[model samples]
Target: MASIYDFEAETLDGRPAPLSAYKGQVVLIVNTASKCGFTRQYEGLEALHRRYRDRGLVVLGFPCNQFGQQEPGDAAEIASFCALTYDVDFPMMRKIDVNGPKAHPLYAYLKKAKKGVLGTEAVKWNFTKFLVDRDGQVVGRFAPTVEPKALEGAIEALL
Candidate 1:
């Protein structure tokens, strides 16, 4: 049924990754940016990953430069920044577009499955987050302004 397992993405190093590897794990898929105002959320996201990874929760970050070019950096640079700034240990995908024609297919499917505020499918900005269940179904969508710590309860419930 076109589950997330059907999608293949590139890692921060540009290596191919199939979502099937994360099956049966609750995943928090977030579109992120390094220079945006919402960049601080990386800390909270990493915290969530560290806290619940033992409980089968995986937080995946997908860097996107679409929103005002806030994430203008190559994979290595982004990886380094994330590691240094937030101590992020979770997996992160290569830079991708989350909206418009260049949008990644996985993101397109996620958007269709769970629209944001006012039935909008197009992402409004950076740090837009999607909560996915063990079955790879999208369960919720959080706006960019929504702080990452605010998702702890929802994430715990899913885990």
Candidate 2:
């Protein structure tokens, strides 16, 4: 079966990043926005990264503007905002559409791997999360409002 490792994404700096590089790690891939109500989730995400990184947790942020254009900013601008406002240290990828023809390849694979509420694979908003196991299999899909702390137990079990 195809795994998440089969996908590749662009870094915020526009370089190719093969998901295979995250092999053997429990990865939490989140679609993010800077101006949305759920933007504050960055704090919790960063906390999750710090708390479990040594245990193979890889939290990846992909700033997307598909939902109400909440992340309308250039690459440099997003980087500055994350660094200055949230002190974000986790890996963040280039801005990309999460729900259209232009959707990032990584997101496409994630949605195909894990369906959400009502058996829908489409992402409804920013902060939607896809958690993958160590073997590159997508495990669970989380709604945008599901707080990062709430994922601790599931993540621990996967680890």
Candidate 3:
């Protein structure tokens, strides 16, 4: 059984980001957009990352344009926006499709591991979050509406 650690993605700066590096950490994987109404959640997510990172929580953001084209910027632009606007210190991956034929393999694995409402595998929108345990298992799927703070308890438990 392949786990989340089996996947690799590109960092916003274009470096290889292998999930295996986070094998013993609690991970919050979110598909994000810069122009969405929930874009403000970046602040909250950053807060969560700062607050729990010492306890083994890692917040990994993946910029996606599939939802209303909210995140249309290129890698450098996205990185600048996140740093200047939200002071996001957590890892941000390069833009990637979270749906359709070109969806990233990590996302495909996450969706299959934890289907959404009514067992639908498709990611409905941006900011959708997947929680992974230290053992690299997907344990929870949160909708775009769920705030990052709301997952603190769950993350703490995993840590």
Candidate 4:
């Protein structure tokens, strides 16, 4: 019964980031890519972060390159793109796999806690989102097609 707080990941700057630091906060976790079709969702995600962060919401972007090699950028390149293009101020994690054998452990836990559509655990594409409550429980999963702004209601409920 591991909660998200049990996991740790490296930040875009290559520094250790413990999920425990976000304990008791509602978390929006998304697998992102700089060159994917859904990459624009970063704007909406940043909006969510800005609009609700003070109210206990934290948006975490995990740059993933598993699909079509959309996020084929090094740490610096990814960070620069996110900042310059979308003005993303939310925490961004280092690039990592969202599927397959090399998937990050945090993603593995997330997929297990809340299976995708059709009960499948694999992440189909970039921008897939997982919402965690203040208690660190996975409460919802959103497909890549679900726009980040559409999640406001669900996020407000948890807040």
Q: What is the C-alpha lDDT of each candidate?
A: 0.93, 0.92, 0.95, 0.96
Q: Estimate each model's TM-score.
A: 0.97, 0.97, 0.99, 0.99
List the candidate 2 regions with Cα displacement exceeding 4 Å: none
For residues 7-63, what per-residue lDDT tens digits would candidate 2 score against the true structure? 888888888889899999999999999999999999999999999999999999999
lDDT of 3 by residue, 36-105 (tens): 9999999999999999989899999999999899999999999999999999999999999988899999
User: On residues 37-113, what C-alpha lDDT tens digit does candidate 4 reach at each position?
Assistant: 99989999999999999999999999998899999999999999999999999999999998899999999999999
**lDDT computed for candidate 3:** 0.95
- lDDT pick, better of 1 and 4: 4
Better TM-score candidate (1, 3): 3
Clashes of 2: 0
Q: What CA RMSD would you report for each candidate? A: 0.8, 0.8, 0.5, 0.6
The lDDT, on a scale of 0 to 1, for candidate 4 is: 0.96
1-159, model 1: which lDDT tens digit per residue? 777888989999878999999999999999999999999999999988998999999999999999999999999999999999899999999999999999999999999999988899999999999999999999999998888889989988887
Give the Å shift of residue 153 in candidate 2. Answer: 0.2
Q: List the residue pairs that clash in candidate 3.
A: none
Q: Report backbone clashes per prediction.
A: 0, 0, 0, 0
User: Model 4 off-target regions past 4 Å?
Assistant: none
